[model samples]
Target: MQNSFVKVPLWLFERVVGFLLALPIPIYSSAVYGLVTNMRGLPHMLGMYIRGLYYRQKLGLMEPNVFIDQGVFFAYPQGVELKEFSYIDKNVLVMSKTAKVGRRVHIAPRVFISGGGDFEIENYACIATNSNIITSTEVLKDGARCSGPMVSADQRRVFRGKVLIKKDAFIGANATLLPGVTIETGAVVGAGVTAAKSTEPWGVYVGERAQRVGTRDSVLCPDN
Candidate 1:
């Protein structure tokens, strides 16, 4: 019998590319900072342009109007797809071997969406600032440790499961969405809530354990 599994060196390549692309920032800043003062917009545009260029040059593809801010780290750009009108805010870190995002999704600042498995977010979904969506099993540091309020042995499976936020779902600020969880269409997840299980469609969820507080006809849209 022959071995059936084929091992691809994707992790090594990701690290190497990340390192090479990040190397020029320090050098460029050191050389140009002295000559340019009050140049705020230029640096941001240049960083965005460089990030876009690196994504295209290294990965061979990137959709238009996908804004990547400075210091945003991605494990595999090829596995990530941002549709039209999608905005990834500053300092956001996304790591997914396979992740698909739909159009007009607003990912706020300091958000972390990571998983080894695939995670999908439908169009018009609003993810508030500092929200965390943990998708794969590797993301959990300890599978056996379960001491916290939200901790359980089953929580370890979150990293392995696929997370789906349906269209028009609103994830409020500082919320933690665990694995295998699906936010149904028009659902509203309140701020600072940790959802360990799936939520019903068109309902308002709150609290640490994320219980259903109320029912609404439609999902609560984020403030513009």
Candidate 2:
């Protein structure tokens, strides 16, 4: 009876703490650290609940059922769309805008997605661990110097484009999908590959510049 009594206040205390702490979380990142990342380590499912509350308040409550594991950082939550049954695993850094993540999408741990707010992961698409999807990169001209992030856009050459991963496409581990690249439906981008262009439907790409290795039969694919 004494242990039960002790558990009640502990639970209530965490609830109150979560509620109060979430009020200070804004819609964007902070200079000192990440506001979303600061919301980490809240003790399991309660942490997901509190993180959901923060996102719901800041990002208009995108989805109630999406599971965002601890240690994940969101640089811009205002531009993200979290659909149902989506699982964003641990330590994933989402520093992109216009991140349209469709239903049942699985973004694995340590996946870094950054861009010009024009990236889309359609329904049932799975991005494996340690993959990078970047949309905007600084281009170096012969006479111009490479500058840092704090520098103004006019001072540097920047290239921004759209990245789209269509329905049922699978991105293998440690892959890098650059600007203007589209992983078409049912295509598989193999591990350690870097792509700079769009892929064909049911195509298997395996090299640095997306060299076509083989093709998968589209008839055997499944959709949930």
Return the top candidate by lDDT. 2
Point out where model 1 deviates above 4 Å: 1-44, 59-61, 138-159, 219-224
lDDT of 2: 0.79
Clashing pairs in 1: 135-159, 136-159, 136-160, 137-159, 137-160
What residue pairs clash in candidate 2, if any at all?
56-61, 97-117
lDDT of 1 by residue, 193-216 (tens): 999899998889999889998986
* Model 1 weakest lDDT span, ten residues long: 33-42
lDDT score of residue 204 within candidate 2: 95
Q: In the order shown, what is each candidate's alpha-carbon RMSD?
A: 12.0, 5.9
